[model samples]
Target: MKKIKLGNSELEVGEISLGCMRMNELSKKDAAEVIENALDCGVDLFDHADIYGGGESEEVFADAIGMNDDVREKMKLQTKCGIRKGFFDFSKDHILESVEGSLRRLKTDYVDTLLLHRPDALMEPEEVAEAFTELKESGKVRYFGVSNQNPMQMELLSKYLKDDLIINQLQLSLVHTPMIDAGFNVNMQNDPAIVRDSNVIEYCRLNDISIQAWSPFQHGMIEGPFIGNEAFPEVNAKLQELAEKKGVTDSAIATAWILRHPAHIQPVVGTMNKGRLQDIVKASDIELSRQEWYELYRAAGNDLP
Candidate 1:
């Protein structure tokens, strides 16, 4: 697996990180096996959120890691907070409480990074900064980030916080790339495609904030699977062709297409299958040529100018 610096932090994480959302449903032994497989495959960063499986995911991960001392030292653990069951909370109390709960559940004291699960509309940046400060001072969290935030929201948080926002996790994939697609199809009046998050990719690249891509294989907002789906047959066909050419699996090709971008997006894969995890790490090595990258983009229904 390839390692890349996560934003400006001293920590360098695997280019392909494992998302542990589904582990909550797996048996403890099965979850441990899957995690061990990911480590053996060179994945060092593990992603999680507080709401995954009603907090069972973090507990399972804690159990899995606590069972193995050696594995605990070799991997970096990252989790998210700020998401409530029916609302959002970024108050200092909630932030501090969530981090402690996550730490107790993960069987670790310090998270390599703690990302705000999502943007809270009623967020007070000062309160979040206070919580982050307390966590950093107490050695509970080393880095800070956010998920599903636009550029303006990031700016607001940055204005009040002292620490560098290392990452801004976003929903991005070949079929769901309005951040990239909208820029190319500009000036098409009345076209919703022409109006998306205005230059979020450029903003992150300019600010040295790493982009973590969640749902990297989904065609859209959790509607259905993209790989081999009849709605995306053209894209899947091209993915298969490139996968064969690169000697990687079709899933790896799909992942590589995202990694090939200059923005340096890290794919947070949600697969619980150990074999699928191995295949995803292989994607870090399958470099797509410029034409191949564009071919997949076009296959996703974007017109070439």
Candidate 2:
């Protein structure tokens, strides 16, 4: 896999990141196989959230990987906090407590990156800055980021953060692409013109925040993967054609579509199936051209004009 600098941070990571949200469902043996497969595929970043499987995913991952410092040093581990049982929390108390929980579960002293899993409406940036300063000073978290956040939201948090927010994880894919759609349909009286998330894609690019694309194959927030979903025949056909053309799996074509962007967005693969993980890695080498990228955009029922 290719290596890319994580935003303005000094950490360089794999072009593709593995989302460990599903790890808790697997046994330790299976989880270890998945981790080994991911490592063999050049995936070096593992993304997690405190709420994922009620923190069991991180625990399973730590046990599966043996929590060896020498092995951990070869990869980058990034986990998230800021969400609570029924609400979001970014209080200094919550942030500090959450980090401790994560470290204890992951069996690590410090994570490579710690992200706010989601935005807290009642968040005070000063408290977050204090928590981050403490974490950084004490060697608990090396870098920081956010997930599903907008430009102004980050601007609010960055106001008090001593370090740059290096990442903004977003829900993006070939089908669920409001960000790309809004960029082209701007100033128009159409449904696609709805500027969601304050057009954070361009904003993050301009601000040097790397985007991490989550659920790259999903059709909607909850509709699940679109690869074999019968509702998306056009997209499935297009993906099949490209997959055969490139001698890669259809899943790789879907993943490559996201990585094709100049933003250098990292697609966080959530699959635990070893075969599927190997297939997804094929995306790292196939760079989609401008026409191919737009073809996919249109195939997913997106209108250019």
Candidate 3:
């Protein structure tokens, strides 16, 4: 439970943050127990979203916080907006309304960070900037960032917005890391797959924007969990070997693979299992060497060059 300074923001957040997307279906007591476990393990950053479980996730997280006032003050809370069921909206009205709803749901006056859930094709940078300015001036949101945005989109927003873009949440995992893999196999003909994310990893790092990796243990986009999936037998075999060597769970090994990168990425874990949460916290301490890091990368079939 080490802390890292968020990009250009004075907020020091835990290296591993807890994602509450799945807690909407859990009982209030159970959700409270899970959040308590995270706090006990030194996890201080809790991630939420307005669209997760149709806004029930934020309510459950707020209930957990209400169970303990002292804990609420000790942890940093972050949530995302701008995603609706049918389309994306970054309108000034939507942003303002969403933050108000989030504050009411989380039972907090201000969020540590507020992210635009996804890029809206028709987003007007000026409207977004106005919303941010109003929120910052009103003391509703302390920091701002974006999720699933490329460098060009970020630059577009930065051009009109006055606040620093602090983070970019991206779908990154050991098996589905096209952002890292595409660069290695850049010149392969007949490979439209060779071009993905437009080198977002390097772009964010160079621009001083922190990268938060979501779905860190998934093999693909919601197809299934990769922790024990049979399709990735070879990958699981290597994970087991590393887990044994590091004296941590295979899930931790998977998380470590993401953390071992020099980009200083934070893994926003979506696990609800208390044991799994503890294992991920332990994974942060298991530093993989350069060779071991690439070993897992190659095992995951990313060694094109």
Candidate 4:
């Protein structure tokens, strides 16, 4: 895997990171194999959430791999908090408690990064800032970021944050191209011209915040990947054509499409299957040209004005 300087942070992370949301469902033996394959593929970053399998994912990860000093030192671990049973909380107490629970579950003293899982409506920037300050000073979290937030939301939080927000996780893929679409259809009188994210991609780029692309292969919201889905024949055909040309799997083509962006979007693939994981990591070595990238975009049901 190729490495990229993650935004303005001091950490250099792999171009592709593994998402361990589903790892809780795997047995120790199966999860161990998955982690081994990821390490072999040079994937050094692992993403998690406090709610993943009710925190069993982190426990399983620690138990499965026996994460000792050597194993923990080899990779970077990141987790998100702030989401609760029926609401979101960014209070200082919740933020501090979340990281403490994560560290205890993962059997680690610190996580390389921590993210606010989602925007909390009642979030007070001052409280978040205080929590982050404590976490940073305590050596519990080295960097901080947010997920599913637009530019203005980020701006509001950054106003009180003492540290640079190193990352902003968002959804981006071939079929789910609203952010990219709004960019292309700017000033046009079309549905795609309606901006949804307040130009978050450009904002993050200007602010030196890396955008982590989650669900890289899914089409629509939780509709599953479009690679072999019969509903997306055109995109599938185009993906297969490019995959054949590049001598890689279609899934790699899908992932490469995200990596080809100039923003240096890092993909967080959540595949537990070792074979599929290896295939997706091939995207790091594949580069799609401008024309090819646009072609895939159009094939995914978008029209250029």
Candidate 5:
């Protein structure tokens, strides 16, 4: 696997990390095998969110891998907070409470990184800063980041945050390229040029924040993956063609398409199947040429000016 620095932090994580979102779906033995497979594949970073499987995902992961220092030293843990049942909460109390709950379920003293799951419109940056201060001083979290946040949103928190925000997790893939679409369609009258995300990619690059690409193969948010879905026949045909040429799984081709970007994005593969996860991790070894990358991009129903 390819290793890259996580933002400005000293932590060097695998370019293709594993997201433990569906880990709760597996039994103890299956979860253990999945975790083992990832580690064996050189994936040291494990991503988790408190709301995944109603917090049972973390519990399953913790049970699968003991929380002792020896095991913890071999891997890095990153989890998210801020999403409540029906609303988003970033208050100091909620942040602290959520982290404590995660610690209890994860059976760890301090997670390597803690991300704000989603932007809370009513968030008080000062309160969050205070909570982060306590967490850092208490050694409960080593780094901080946000998920699904735009440049202005991160700027609001960065203004009051003493710690450097190292990551911004967003949805990105070959078929789903809103961030890329707006860039190329800047002067067009089409809806693709509407600038839904305010050029977050450039903003993140300027600030040196690592972009973590979630759902690298999914065509829509919370929808079926694009690999073999009939809705994306064009993309599937191109992916299969490339997979044959590259001698890797079509899933790896799908992931390598994301890794080819200079943004140095970390693709969070959330597959529970060990074989699928292994195939996806192999993307770190595959390199796509400029022509091939654009070919796959255009195959996904995107156009160039």
Candidate 6:
């Protein structure tokens, strides 16, 4: 139920947001239930991408909720672009075209935020600046961000952008935590100490760019949830232990671990089941202590130098 300022913007959103990547798989009736339940659980932000469900997710979301002026005003909608069928495109024309498509599908006048889905090696910052300026001037996007970008990538984009980059979406969880692992094992000669993300956590914190954790419960790249998976028994046991102590589900404890970090990272949950959604939202209320947080971290088989 707690809200935080979203990056450098004036928007105050819930600590936990809903990720709509799999919403297209649900029926309109079921999707409606999911949306309604999310709002009831104090989630005010929804994240999407141009290619999710082959663009059917956005269409289904709008139709399921029977989107109206009132309904649109109550929640913050975020969508990402740049990734194409066979390549990444940050060209001005592609950026412009992508937002128009998203708007038409979402039935919204403007998205609360727009993000580059992933890094585009062929990106021209000048072209991106031009596209973003046009979108801002035309009232199609209110804020801008990037996903899976490192500090240098963001810095390069920031140099040409007229507006500040507000959010950087990344993968972070108990099992998939390279960003956090490198921080603890700094300067050590270990696999965990190999810095891959360029200290993005510290970069985001110092720059006030909110890091939105995309897979808080997943172990690998969309492999599956680790909460109840037999492969992750140690962490699951630790999660269960903490859940019982806090009177919440093991999933909630996992989510709370992400929220406990001082960086103020927000987790974008993608569960479609209303009951599971409610259980996960309980994470916003539970606060994990430093000792408990590290215990869960170590139980996940992560080594410290």
lDDT of each: 0.88, 0.92, 0.88, 0.94, 0.92, 0.94
Tens digits of per-residue lDDT for model 4 on 1-305? 88998889889988999999999999999999999899999898999999999999999999998989999989999999999999999999999999999999999999999999999999999999999999999999999999999998899999999999999999888899887888888799999999999999999999999999999988776878888999999999999999999999999999999999999999999999999999999999998999999999889988989
Candidate 3 accuracy as lDDT: 0.88
- Give lDDT: candidate 6, residue 42: 95
Candidate 6, pairs of clashing residues? none
Candidate 4 residue runs with Cα over 4 Å from true position = none
Query: 1 or 5: which has the higher lDDT?
Result: 5
Candidate 6: which stretches are off by over 4 Å? none
Predicted candidate 3 versus true structure: per-residue lDDT over 184-245, tens digit per residue = 66677735346668789889888889999999988778897877888888789999999998
Q: Per-residue CA lDDT of candidate 6, range 261-290, in tens?
A: 999999999988999999999999998999
Query: Per-residue lDDT of 1-305 in model 5, one digit per residue for the tens?
Result: 88999999999988989999999999988999989899999999999989999999999999988667889988999999999888999999999998998899999999999999999999999999999999999999999999999999999899999989999999998888998899989899988888999899999999989999998888788887888899888989999999999899999998999899999999998888888888888888998999999999899998887
Q: Which TM-score value belongs to model 4?
A: 0.99
4 or 5: which has the higher lDDT? 4
In lDDT terms, which candidate is top?
A: 6
> What's each prediction's TM-score?
0.96, 0.98, 0.96, 0.99, 0.98, 0.99
Q: Which pairs clash in the backbone of model 1?
A: none
Model 5: lDDT to the true structure: 0.92
lDDT, residue 127, model 5: 93
In model 2, which range of ten residues has the least summed lDDT? Answer: 216-225
Q: What global local distance difference test value does model 1 have?
A: 0.88
